[model samples]
Target: MNPAGDPFLEACSKTFEDQFSPLEVAGIGSFGIVFSATTKSKSHIDKLGTPQHRDASEGSGTQALQAVKLCLPGCPSGIKGSTSRLQAEIEAMRRVSKNTTPSVRHLFAELYAFNTSNEPWYSMEFILPGVTLQQVFDVASAASYPFPEEIVFHVADQAARAFQYLHDQCRFVCTDISQSNMMLRYPGKEVSVMPDLVLIDWSFWAEASDQTTTCAVRNLYNCLAPVFFDAGWRCSRRHDRDSCAASGVFHSC
Candidate 1:
């Protein structure tokens, strides 16, 4: 961590203050800057995948107090297709928070209160000592290490549960499900050595109101339902099902 007394930290602190009327910036993301406070929180705007990161721990957290995602106001119009996508996402998140069941890992950080000081910023929980799956994958891949079957089964089960909850209970489809958004919990002495996976980031959640349009954007297309490609793809739930299935196979003897 940079020195708290460093000028950069002070500048970030000032940016947070100017936006939230006295909050401190805790971190930044591709879409906005995240600020923490005693009573409220705020985030500044930026483009998709534009939030910079110095490390991977930003992705973990199981409870509201564990994490937050501040969103930007306007998109380049050329890129977002519509400016209200962010706002729509916020509303979608509200629905998700209410509809979420206990068994599933909530894909979004809960909005405690929003900062209306400027643009559109909202405060949410902060994940403590949580790490993103992307980070774990990097370490695993870089080390050329193969995860044990038992560990893979353990982590994959958690992710599958989260997916099943979203699909069955919430009647929602996560438009984005990838390593980058999955998080690992804070370790405790009693915690299983098996890694825990938590779903995070709901910017691309799908609902009944959503149109049956094809998403060609790299973000939405890569993990899209195969039905998206063939239009007659047999297994409608191919996306999540296949990913989890593959992991399961890897874990099974």
Candidate 2:
């Protein structure tokens, strides 16, 4: 808990009704506030949701708890229009989810409700118990940990599989495949990490099926597909290849 008169928390809390409290500022940018919450809705019985850990005896004990996410448009500084972008993202998720497989949580924009009557806002599922691979990498990198081939391969494999689905099946080229966009739905259960990884954030993507044009530029060291440097070149499946071998670090925003 913060101080009683914490203006930041108070301002954020006022954004939502009394039911859902702002648990924490998950991600803060010029866009808006991303909060993890516990809802006050009745009949919220605890059902056997997705498992995050696997039972040791059965060699499976990585089942995680459940959670909810609230996306508020506009940050404290009011630099960007989160409301409009939120709508676009939700619409994109809806269209993509219909064709995506259950294993790939690519289209997980399950909107619980919205409050457009007054101001625009976004409320959706809160995938819990599991964390993002970005978080895992942060911990390892912060400790100056060296990567084992198995771990690197495992993470890359999971991401690559999701990317394949997004490109091949969904026919969408996700220009932003950073660690922050990769979320874990269920952890150590019977589900393999390969498919459990949910690729999120389509703000910098191009949906070839829809023929949408994207002017977003992404040249980050980590998720930089070769075509990012091709100025004015549209995002397509052909650019995802790694044309050169470069050794460095990748960071997620």
Candidate 3:
């Protein structure tokens, strides 16, 4: 329960660990804490002299914006052991990255799995210039603010694309698709046509399996009832993850 004495931090010492400087707390999940970090590779640090004095450009590159997630055992997100679930997520991320087309792959972040002192964790891209759909909905509803129909259409299109890529291409289902699990890129911007959205929270994102049907139904309820309905939109799609695969579709793209 101690922050400073946490296993993830304790395991991370030298070996690229020093490269990551945690700037602030991102959010807390049932089992872990996330940090928005400024990270440089070992070579990047050597070139910059001090990791502390790294300029904005240093963190502006490919590995610049990253999210560090430290796992806690038996988190509510996992039905099996936390370690097993963490490994599964790493696999899922890779599948999406390697199996999908470049345009579709760019819509999601890359994941890297690391372990130190027998403690395992992963770091991923921190999607920014955006806010969680949950936060957006809660605040707007409280203020009785109604977003334009244009924004809704944008959101709908982007979400459909992301979900299709996951289901048909990645062969994974976002079994939990609540507002918090979705984000709208570039929040507060007036320009809206195709809503730039990204799906977050891989905890319940699983490969298409026998249990996908139940998960899909539950996910539809969690996602549809509150946000879409409140926004005066209706969306429904049948969940058939298994059948959606391999219509002359190779696992590899």
lDDT of each structure?
Answer: 0.45, 0.46, 0.56
Tens digit of lDDT per residue, candidate 3, span 110-136? 454444236545445444446778887
lDDT of 2 by residue, 143-234 (tens): 65554443343444455555556657766666555657666555422245432455545545667543331221122334422212221222
The alpha-carbon RMSD values of the candidates against the true structure, listed in the order shown, are: 10.7, 8.7, 8.7
Worst ten in a row by lDDT for model 1: 45-54
Model 3's C-alpha root-mean-square deviation from the true structure amounts to: 8.7
lDDT of 2 at 23: 60
- Candidate 1 per-residue lDDT, tens place, 73-178, comes to 3223422332244455566566667787645533344443444345434444434357776666566556656555454445545655656565556666667666
User: By the TM-score metric, which is better: model 2 or model 3?
Assistant: 3
TM-scores of all predicted structures: 0.55, 0.60, 0.67
* Per-residue lDDT of 203 in model 1: 59
TM-score of 2: 0.60
Q: Residue 117 lDDT in model 1? A: 46
Give the top-scoring candidate (lDDT): 3
Best by TM-score: 3
Model 2 Cα displacement at 137 (Å)? 3.1
